[model samples]
Target: MSKINHFKGVLFDLDGTLLDTIGDITYAINSALIVVGAEPITTSQCKGLVGRGLKNALKGALELKNREVTPSQLEELVPQMLGSYHRHPYRHTHPYEGVEALLDDLAKEGIALGVLSNKADSLVQPIIRGVLPTHSFVFIRGDKEGWPSKPEPDGVYAFSEAVGVPVDQLLLVGDSEVDYYTAEAAQVDVAIATWGFRSRERLLEAGCRNLYSSVEELRKEVFPWL
Candidate 1:
């Protein structure tokens, strides 16, 4: 395990990796589903739906194909969900226990940190701000019109450029298959966060060999120097 000083930079997935956003996400998802006359899904169900971005989450929550969920309906549902989330983004959202301190320790070690999420920056940025009030990422971004979501290598390059680091020296940490694919595509080392939304078995199945069961575990392996 490399110490915090070993890596020039790090990139994190916002929702599942850093913040335990399942509570608010599940609430928002259920609210949106109800508005659309659809059945609500459980928190566990929401866990499977998240990490892929809002559109995909909506699809999974409603159990509908993309085509079946009309664009017009999505237009309505998105705003409803956003409004609900924005109104109470921090109501139940918070960084997983030790992650806030880990972020601080990384920053103190002069390691540049960045955040990446499938939701648009418009949504993810504020949510992160609301949750991680005591820490900050050097570069934070989410899906935008031109920016491709996770599993796309462009986001990795974008974060590297933003943080003034080379891709090879950046460690991408996330909790899903999307993160694994993204790291592979970007040709960077990735550490799977088992404390986040996904299960240890699932992340391993997704080819994530480096798993951290808790925030402290991650801190130990990635930032032992701190």
Candidate 2:
């Protein structure tokens, strides 16, 4: 493997990547489903539904319920779903173990960090600022009207531009296949976090060659290079 310092900047995926917001998300979606008279899904099902953005998550919920809801109907349902989610955003949310220390170490090393998330911009910023206050992040990309969400590379490119770094020097760290594919599309190096949402086999199938089983492993394999 190349030395850790070889990477100049790192981009992170928010949901399932840096923090576990599953509880809030699952509750919100399930509540929406129930209110809309669709079947409610379990937290386990919700976890798999995540990472593709709120709209996709809702679609997954409908799929699980075996209900066919129109896109227009799903759109109408989004506001209430998100409102319920924001009400208890941090109720059961927390960083994965060792994330804080690893972030601290990276900050101390003067590495540039950024976040790109399918999470709406409204939510991504506060969640990150609330969770990791000490370290300075170069940029963050959240859902904006009409902006393509991941597995597309636009957000990655935006973050790279904001950080004034080439995509080649950027490393994307995320916990899902969406993150891996986004990095691949953007032509950046990637690290799949096993500590997040997806399984090791799934990550491998998604074409993620670099995998970190723990935050400490990330610190060892990636921090030194940054």
Give the best candidate by TM-score. Answer: 2
Misplaced by over 4 Å in model 2 are 1-3
List the pairs of residues colliding in candidate 2.
Answer: 4-225, 4-226, 5-225
Give the alpha-carbon lDDT of every model: 0.82, 0.81
In candidate 1, where is summed lDDT lowest over 10 consecutive residues?
62-71
TM-score of each: 0.91, 0.93
**Weakest 10 consecutive residues of candidate 2 by summed lDDT:** 1-10
lDDT of 1 by residue, 54-75 (tens): 7678777777422356778777
| Candidate 1: pairs in clash | none
- Cα displacement (angstroms), candidate 2, residue 53, comes to 0.4
- Model 2 error, position 54 (Å): 0.8
